[model samples]
Target: MAGQRRILVIGATGTAGRQVVAQSLKAGAEVRAAARDPGTAGLPDGAEVVRVDLADPDGLRAPLDGVEAVFLLWPFATAEGMPAILDAVAARARRVVYLSSAAVRDHERRIERMIERSGLEWTFLRPHAFAANALRWAGRIRAEAVVREPYGAAAMPPLHERDLAAVAVRALTGDGHDGATYELTGPETLTQAEQATVIGEVIGRPVRWEEISPQAARRRMLDRGWPPEAVDGVLRAQAEMVTEPAAATPTVEEVTGAPARTFRAWVTDHADRFRAP
Candidate 1:
């Protein structure tokens, strides 16, 4: 933490990346926020926002110049241009902290192989369901005091975006985290219904959860303009969760030296969004 290292953050405008940029700046790191359009990135003050399209990383070579560490968040479903991007980053950067998913756990070797071949110091963050997923129900709850979704009994230990950001900052700036893969989650498990209840409590209203068939939910998502594959993926994931035990881990606390935020706390913090006008 002596000299200011230029840290390149992909998806800097996203929920987690925004926090990463802010936390990195707070930690005295020089942040270079990379997005498709720098003008629209709206990053925190003091960040040098740059345009870098992951779909076509050919012209993105300039952004990696003088960059020491990279915060890579794959915004695409497939790893198409990742090799080129990683090659560019590895050519200049000494370390990379990748924002991965819990799905990576079941496919670790594949991802690890790709990262290891990059020849850069790497840290992988495999975060479970994000508490921000509640935002999907925000519209329904605000309008009708009801959240309709499939799998009310599906349990998830949703990790807060802030906690994930803290861990990413540690990995990006601190030592002893290279080659580590951390599974981050909230401190407690809550079903979809329980999460709705928490939101209701925070908003001081009597919100209710209404379960729908998976097919119905799929149709609803498709009608809302979600890609067909994405709709199917969500329904399949939820169906699997209904019968499987929720995945929970303490890597967030272990890495950041603080406990993970709770679901109720997250809802409480965002209560205004769910409140009825």
Candidate 2:
């Protein structure tokens, strides 16, 4: 059982990492939740919480000790100090499950290569747009009841954070997932406008999407602290999606033995976030 293995969960407070921590605990794994601040990590009582900064390769070594498996979450845009970090992980950990972007950005691919050659059993999970990304509209939706953004036609099968974590737990605790790259998606492909409508339905409000210029959207993203390159990459991905629709996959169900949930279900689960308060 996973109870014998000590799993080191990086980014333990983040979207997918939080779920991994909870599920690993449920599966009886000895979880060492690593965060920059242990007190504020807000993990369960059973966990061995520690301070770890991924940006600092020197400080990363201590956490790898006695860790049988690792749930990696790359929080940076570039692979700076990643080699040293991966080398440290390779020296100790038996396996690693990296949470990567479906876009397969340069940095993600770099980490993938390092892990493959690191001699540790590895699994890559590339998830599509996050359903929680809808929170970006929460403020606007609560105020204006409208989502004003560019690429309203962009189609995406937004995956739920919990579903993504379920697969990570399987790969970490169960066997046969090594060297596998899983492309994950939600149950439906909804356009940006359609997603707005779904939110409106679940929140019992009349919300609509208004198309804006890409330039305006870039400004908004920049104002929110997104770098220029990231903003460009995001808009480019959406622009391509406008014509090429995303498709749902059964990977989450197949791996976790549960059907991938629908966008409507996600909205319902997080309805309080969208509720007018």
Candidate 3:
């Protein structure tokens, strides 16, 4: 195990975080998958699951000990407690790769600035829409093979989680990535309706895109316990995408030396989730 890189994955249970853990272990890194509840994290065998809660920055010290790089996925909507968290990370780790959004929302910008000032080598991954967002339709797809939402024409270059993790692992273990902000996206642009069709094709059924009014969609989301502001933000973004579609980026391939996976490939990988029980 000479020269084994030690990495700490802060959001080890999320979609992208899970992929980062797996891929880092595959690349021969000694990975510590940090979660609030390590016993329930269910990460792969090689990962040393450690208990660490970002909300309670004090808990990070033990997990960050002896770790050289950290892959951070800040789960908070605001930048509260970020300085303390970065302080703890910089105290132990020299490098941090943050999973940031391409939207560069206010909170994301604030956290990025804090990481820069923390004096640790840093990389920001600004990924476009995640292909896993399609999982939001899993229940309806399983029961009725239909997706009901507004702005069926909204177009995005959905990124595969594995691609995002690949870029992250490269930044975590390799050099020449410090101060880099990678704009990550999939290979092609697909409309919401087209994404539904791709899912249907992969699952061997015709899944229909039942377009609803933005108002109705907003109501439904609120009824499902979504914050009013979050619901509004989602609808507004989708509406904008209807007119101005998101563009695909070559950064994924440029960083990982592999072409970004298509939405079809993502669906094929998770087709069983959309199929009947």
Q: In terms of TM-score, which candidate is strongest? A: 3
- Could you tell me which 10 consecutive residues in candidate 3 have the lowest summed lDDT? 1-10
Per-residue C-alpha lDDT of model 3 across residues 1-277, encoded as one tens digit per residue: 3226899998999999999999999999999999888889999999999988777888888888899999999998899989999999999999999999998989999999999899999999999999999999999999999999999999999999999999999999888899999999999999999999999999899999999999999989999999998899899999999999999989999998899999999999999999989
Sort all candidates by lDDT, best to worst: 3, 2, 1
Ten-residue segment with the worst summed lDDT in candidate 1?
104-113
- Any runs in candidate 3 off by more than 4 Å, and if so which? 1-3
TM-score of each: 0.95, 0.96, 0.98
lDDT of 2 by residue, 51-141 (tens): 9987677786788888889999989888788888888888888899999988889989988888888899999999999999898899899
RMSD of each: 1.8, 1.3, 1.3
What are the clashing pairs of model 3?
Answer: none
lDDT of 1 by residue, 113-205 (tens): 688888899999888899999998998899999999999988899888999999999999888998899989999988889999999988889
- Per-residue lDDT, model 2, residue 87, is 84
Q: What lDDT score goes with residue 57 in model 1?
A: 74
Clashing pairs in 2: none
Angstrom error at residue 114, model 2: 0.8
Please count the clashing residue pairs in each candidate, in the order shown: 0, 0, 0
